[model samples]
Target chain A: MPALVLNNISKRYGDVQALDGINLQIQDGEFCVIVGPSGSGKTTLLNIIAGFTKPDDGEVTVDGKPYNQLSPRDRNIGMVFQDIGLFSHLTVRKNISFGLEIKKSSKKDIDKRVEEIADRLKIRKLLDKKVRLLSGGEAQRVAIGRTLITNPSFFLFDEPLGNLDANLRVEMLTEIKRLHLHLKKTFIYVTHDQEQALSAASRVMIMKDGKALQKGPPREIYNNPIGKFVAEFFGVPSMNLIDGTIIPEEDGSLFQGAGLNVKVKGYSQSKKAEVTLGVRPTDVVVGNQITEDGFGTINSLELLGDKNQIYLTLEQEKSIIAVTSPEVRPELEERVKIKLKENRIFLFDRDQGGRLYP
Target chain B: MSERIKRKGKIPVNIIMLLPTNIIILFLIIIPTILVIWFSLVNFQPTFGINFWQSKFVFLDNYFKILMDDEFVKAVIRTVYISLICLGVEFTIGLLIASILTGNIHGKKILYPLLIIPIMIPPIVIGNNFWLIFSANGPVNQIISIILNTEFKASWFSHPKYAIIPIILSEIWHWYPLTFLILFSGLVNISTSEIRAAKILGATEWQLSWRIKFPKLKGIITIALVIRMMEALKVFDVVHLLTHGGPGTRTQTISFYLFKYGFKYSRISYVSAGAWIILFISLLGFSLALRSVLVERK
Candidate 1:
């Protein structure tokens, strides 16, 4: 059975809809991530699951039981907030033991659990210190330990490492991934960082404008996006989109725009007049021309330390980006020919933003 | 050696900037306090108006006389008792009101202004109003008669036994708002996450208040207690207006008794001595309280 199910859940704050018809099913022991930009209702969805907030309509079921009826204390769900919501007044030991104390665990059991978790988190020595005295990473660990000591069946992390510095964030991310592997519990994490989502989430739910735009494993999300929004939202430097029109050629089909013509390779039947062509920066190649029906480029290259991103402008002043190794560097304002990898290309209807061809 | 005369002399700017305030403090507060101390040591006649050099020095005689006097001793005890009782009631009720208002209730915003209206009114006005209400055959006695179904009408001001109640009630009503303001600010500053964390950690309602919120509020509570204690000990305006040392000297607080001796009986030296004794007690009490509070925090 799915460990968590959000069925037709909708939430509204006054006239603004924060969550519109969100439905998700997270399997047991699955590390699911909801990825979105700010105000995309990612935190709202997690809050609903953690029972900090209530959905305006529909139901949340946990372990096949209706969860909306349960209060936060009864939800049996552990939450680590983005703000490291540690009890500032309590000692680190007390903060960790708080959950166990609430469960009415025996004092001996509480002590054992707190110690075991603290030792694992490497905060055994800091236990007697007040939470205010702890460093950011230490406080985050204590917050995690506090929630984990309760031994809940599921864990919900709301940008748990967002407050850490670069090195500590990376360390905490790896530690969280390791903890998920060790515990094997249902984990629902939220973040706006695409790289974080790609690295950690087994399955990612991409949210935009208060709704899920696409949901898939990271590879599928990066390679075969379902729409223009999804394609542009993922990947570093993002996918470059070119506006062009499809035309009927003598033999098959050709896409022509801005004094550029490219043979549409794989589509069996294409009659759409207007479409957007999308290709990742890494896939677009710049080299000498071998054919008459391929797009040419007026290239401008930028050095990005290890690699270079060459901007290709066509005759109509339209630009596309191509990622190339710095060793194969193009000179300043060089004229180069371009080829779009047919299999790596993405096509979407201009009006609806829906994917037409992958 | 002649080159040293050419160097610019240091200007005392720190003293310059503070000179005005320092002079005022010394003249208005510090000098009068020192004069009070000096006056308490000397005996003066009505003819010799506070010329301490001409007046014979009578060290500790004023203190001894006031300490041994039965009326002065009773007044001291009554004042202490009344102040302590008023402080306790005000602190407890103020905390209760603050906590209740902190919760999500319907009329909180409206009730804040309404509750503070009583505190904003002048203390003398409140005293007079309470005096009228607690008079013989007044509202309090009428309410008591209807409840008990008896014709027991005791004069609150005239009877020494019933006099302390009115003073306590008036002081409580006037100063409870100060306590409420302090504690309310304390409650607002407490981290809501701590409360939520406590609940999720399985703390019941009682534990949440006592363990989480109360500890967080210790600093503000100390501030509130000290301020309230100081205000209570100097309980003069309301008592003077309500009873004016009463039908006898039952409700004679230190300040009112000082006023009676200094202005009414023209015994300035005795009143000054009494004032110094009260000041010493207040200073010592605050110092001890602060020391204990700090030591306990360790």
Candidate 2:
């Protein structure tokens, strides 16, 4: 059974359709991360499920119970905000025990539970300190501990790691993933950073303009994105999309545009006349000599330890990026042949931007 | 030698920049305070054919007289009573209004300014207006008469037992808005995420207020209370304008009592002693409050 299901969720804020007919389901004990750009209604959907916001039309079923009419407190969901909303007036211990105190738990039980949680989160030494005195990563652990002590059915994180520095963010991200594993509870995390989403999520949902565009395991979504947006939104440095048209030939087909011609061998039955050929930067082969596909002048190079990101301008001023071994260093303004691995190229319809060929 | 000269020149320039302010302080504050102290030590009655400097030196005599005087003692107690009542009522009502206003309510923009209208009016004008409203044939009596189904022409200003009621009411009406405005700003400044986190943690509305909102607002609450308490302790305008400290000094606050002695009776020495005592008490209270707030912050 799915732990949480959102059926036909829709919400509008004045002229903005914040969420439009969003349908989703998270299986029990699955780590589901909703990844989207800002204003994609990711946070709005979380708010609706947590009962902080009322959806215009939807049913939020949690563990086979209708939760739409319940208050946030009654919904049994815990959320850690991006701001790490720990009560600054309280000590770390107090902040963690707050939910239990609200429930009027026994003092002994609360104390024991708080100590257990503090030990689990490795913040026992900081328990007596004021929340404002804590470092960013420490405060983040305390925020998670606060929710953990409540023993809610689902843990929702709304960009909880957005405020941390890069090093601290990775540390906390690993800690959160470990926490989900140890708890064995369903976790619904939301973030705009695709790297975090890909690294931590067992299943990923990509949203855009208040719609869930794709949902699957991280690798499935990355390898077979349903549309151009998802394909570009997932990878760092993004996927390179070249505008072109497909012409059916005797053997297979030919994609011709932007001062280059490449044979599309496998997709012989593709009927789309106009298409956008998508390629990841790692798949673009660059060499000193001309290839059958195309050639371009190197604009810049960014070193990424073992690899280098090469920016190239194609024949008609169209730019494309390629990642290659650092050993393939070329001087700026040097013309290099570029070849797209035929099997790795993705063809998307020009108008609708939907995938036309895998 | 050049560096030393530059440092010396900078010191003089700083002093020169502060010279005008120091002179103004000397003339406006320091001189008057010294004069008041001097007057308090001497029996300076202008009613007599003697100037202030020529008055008889009676060290501590005016202070003793103030302590022994029943009217002064009663005025101090009345002032305390009025201040406590006003602070209590104003804080409770102001906090309630501020809390309600902080919610997602419509017309809040319009209502907020309207609520502040009473505070914008001069206290003397508010006193006069309230005096008219509590008059024998005014709207208050008219409403009471209708409610009671009789001609309830009870005189609020002259009744010996209840004469201070109208003074307290007018003071609250003229000042509660200040407390409300401060608290409302503080309440709104609390992060919505903190409130939401509390709710998601299963905090009830009351729990959210006392646990999250109230703790965050402690410093602001202290400031509002201190400001209102100080102003309330100096309650004079409404009492003087509405009741004139009587139907027999029934509403005589310390400020009104001092005003009467200094201006009406020309007992400058006695009033000065009383003023010093009140000032010392006020400073003591203010310091205690500030110390507690500072310590809590740490």
Candidate 3:
């Protein structure tokens, strides 16, 4: 059974439709991450799940039980906020055992669980210290420890590591992955940073404009995004989108636009004429030919230690980006040949931007 | 000679900038305090006006007499009692109103300023208005009569047993908004994320206040109470205008009692001694208040 399921969730604030009929099912012990830009209703969905926000219309079923009327105190779900909301008044031990205390557990049980959680989170020496005295990363661990000691059925994290420095974000990312592996509890994490989303999520749900565009494994999402927005949201150098047209032939279709031509075999029977082609930079093959069909000069180059990001303008004044290894360093404004792989290229309709599968 | 001139050129510009302010403080505060102490130390009594040279030196006599006076001791006790009762009531009611104003209710912008209207009225007007309201033929007496189901035309300001209640009510009415404003600012400053975190950790509304919010508001509550304490200890205008320390001296505070001895009866030496005692108490109260503020900062 799924650990949690949201059916037809809808919320509105004045004139803004914050969430529009969102339906999702999160499986048991699955590490699901919602990746979106700001104002995409990701945090609103999480709040609705935690019962901190009431949706206009929805049914939230947790462990196969309807939880629409349950208060956050009774929801049995632990959420860590993006701001690391550790209580400034409580000691580390008291904060960790707060949930158990509210549940009215015995004092001995509370102490044992607090010690166990502290030792697990590596905050053993900080049990008696006030939360106000802790550093940012230490406070983050205390927040996580506070949620973990409760052992809830589902965990919600709303950009919990967004405040940490880059190095510490990566470190905590690994720590969270390891914790998920050890405990096998369902984790639902939300982040606007695409790179962090790709690195951390086991299953990714790409959201835009208060709607979930696609949900799948992270690799599939990076490889095949269904819409133009999701296609652009997930890559380091986002996928280059070019407007083009497809001509159907006897056994194949030829795509031609922006000084490039490609023959695709899968959509010979398709009647689509105009299309938008999206190509990932990694799929563009570069060569030193002077008369190649898809040719452009290097406008600029960014060396990322392992790869070089090449920005080029085509013969039609169109921009395309290509990523190559560090050894293929072309000079400034040097002409280079680019090739597009027929099967790897994605075609979308011109107006609607839905993938055309050609 | 060149070295001396160089040293003189660097004569602390910041200290020179503060010179005028220091001189003003010395003249207005320090010099007057020294004169009050000198006047309290001697019997400067004169049958006629302006005879300071004929005064006799009297060491500790005025202090002892005022300290031993039954009326003075009773006034001190009454001041403390009334001040504590007002502080407790105002703080509680102000905190409640501030919480309601800060809650997600509609029309709060219009209601918030309306709550502070009592604070804008002059103190003397407040005293005189409440004096009329608690009179025998006024609306307050009529309301009390309806509540008790009896003929309650008793003058609330003239009864020895009930005179202090009207002053306490009027003062609370005039000053609760001061505490209300401070606490409302404090309430608005607490982020929503902290409350959400506490709720997800299984906190009810009452528990949220007890654990998360009340601890954060400790400093603001201390500040509000300290201000009210300072104003309450020196309170005299309302009492003088409303009751005039009548009804057998039952409603007299220390400040009101000192006015009779200082100007009416012309026991200037004893009045000065009493003023010095009150000043010492105020200094002690401020010292304790300052220590708490410093510790909270740490």
Candidate 4:
């Protein structure tokens, strides 16, 4: 059964519509991630789910029952905050057992559960210490443990690792994924870090301007984003986009733009003024060219340990990034031939930013 | 301090920078404290042409007399009771007001500052204001009569049974806003995300306030309490102005009684001794309260 569902969820802050008819569903025990940039409504959606912010209109259902009217306490949802909101005055044990204590559970049960969660989170030793004295990673675990002790059916993590260092972030990312697998509870994690979303989520939902642009598995979303925003938003070294017009030929059509020309599907809709041709950096092959005229001059490179990110400029001053092996980097300011797979190219209406057709 | 410490091969600028503060402490705090201590030990009744240097030393004679005197003990106990009442009522009302202010109320900027008008008013004015308001024909009796559905005109001043009521009201009115402001600051400092997290983890409204926001505001509440208690313990202006510790000295706070002895009767030595006693008791109370607060937090 679907563990959680949101239908027609909408919120407005003054003039800004924070969430516009947001619709979503997650299967039981599925790890779901909503990734977006700042002010993109990712946090707003989480707030609405956590019952912190009331949406202007929406139906939030968990376990096939409407929970919109239920307070967060009655809804029985657990949340790990982005700020790692551990109770500073409370000891780690008390902080973790907060929900249980609120529920009026027996002392033995609270102690046993607290100990179990502490051992699982590797914070057993710190249980007696005040939360104010914890390190960043330790505090995060306490926050998670505090949420986990309740044994809620649904878990919401709002950028739980946002404050961690790079190494700690990667480590905690793996730990969180493992926890998700172990708990097997529905998880809705919101974060702007696309890498975290890709590494942690079973499914990725990309949002922008209070709208869900696309939702799918991480690999599928990365390889087949529905719009210009999703295509640019998911990838590491974002997809390169160049403006072009669909030039109608007698037989079919050709994507003709600044130093770019390619065949595309027939257009049936009203003629769009401009089209954007997008392809990821890795899709741009170097050295062995696919066709003639599929080449450009090497502009510059951002050095990486294994592969250098090559910036190639074609005619009309349009540049694209190409990942080239460090040993195979083309000479600076010299011409290097680059080619792209026809299937790998994406098309979008430049004016509206919506995906144009195949 | 941090900036000074960061400098390399420079003069000890931080210590030098503290010269003004050191001078102020010397003149304002140390000298006054020494004089108070000296006067507490001597019979320094300045009105009799006996300067502080000439007064005979009586040691702990005044201390024993004051402690053993039933009138002084009663005054001390009354002050303690009044202080406790003010602390309780002020904290409760202040917490409630702060909670309401933090909500989605309108015109918070104006309402907050307006709420502090009582605190901004002079203590003497606060005393007189309550006295007028609680007079036989004043608003208090009028409101009371309205509530009781009867005619009522009782002289709050002449009524010894309720003499302290006016002082309590006046003091709470003058000070609750200070508690409100401090608690409001603390309420704001409590991270909303923490509250949200607690809510999602199944904390009811009461639990949210009790467990999450309350603990987060512990330090600030302690600070507010300490400040309010200190101010309440030293309450004299309102009491003196409102009832003059009258209705037969029923509302005489420790400070008011000390004023009676210190300036009214020209018993300066006894007053200084009382002042020293108060300082000792307040210090003991303050440390005991703070220590328990810290330990409870742990």
Q: Which candidate is the best by lDDT?
A: 2
The fnat of each candidate, in order, is 0.44, 0.83, 0.71, 0.83
Model 3 per-residue lDDT at A121? 86
In terms of DockQ, the best-performing candidate is 2
What are the runs in model 4 whose C-alpha is more than 4 Å off? A250-256, A261-273, A288-290, A302-308, A324-327, B1-32, B46-54, B106-110, B143-152, B293-298
TM-score of chain A of 4: 0.92
Task: Give every collision pair in model 1.
Answer: A102-B202
Q: Cα lDDT of all candidates, in order? A: 0.83, 0.92, 0.86, 0.86
Q: Residue A157 of candidate 2: its Cα lDDT?
A: 97
Docking class of 1: acceptable
- Please state the Cα-based DockQ of model 1 relative to the true two-chain complex: 0.44
Candidate 4 overall lDDT versus native: 0.86
Error of 1 at A257 (Å): 6.4
Writing each residue's lDDT as its tens digit, candidate 2 over B58-132 gives 999999999999999999999999989999999999999999998889998899889999989998899889999
Q: Per-residue lDDT for B21-128 in model 1, tens only?
A: 999999999998888888788886464475556777899898887777787777777788887898889889999999999987898889998877778998878988
Listing every candidate in turn, what is its Cα RMSD in Å to the true structure after a full C-alpha superposition? 4.2, 2.7, 3.5, 4.1
Error of 3 at B250 (Å): 1.3
Predicted candidate 2: what Cα RMSD to the true structure? 2.7
Taking the tens digit of each residue's C-alpha lDDT, what string does model 4 give over B1-298? 3444546666677777998899999999999889888877888887888887788988988888788888888998998999999999999999999999999999989997799999888877777788889988999999999999999999887788798988898888889999999999999888877777777777778988988888778778888999999998888997878788988988888998998988888888888788889899999988987987788765
Worst 10 residues of 2 chain A by lDDT: A287-296
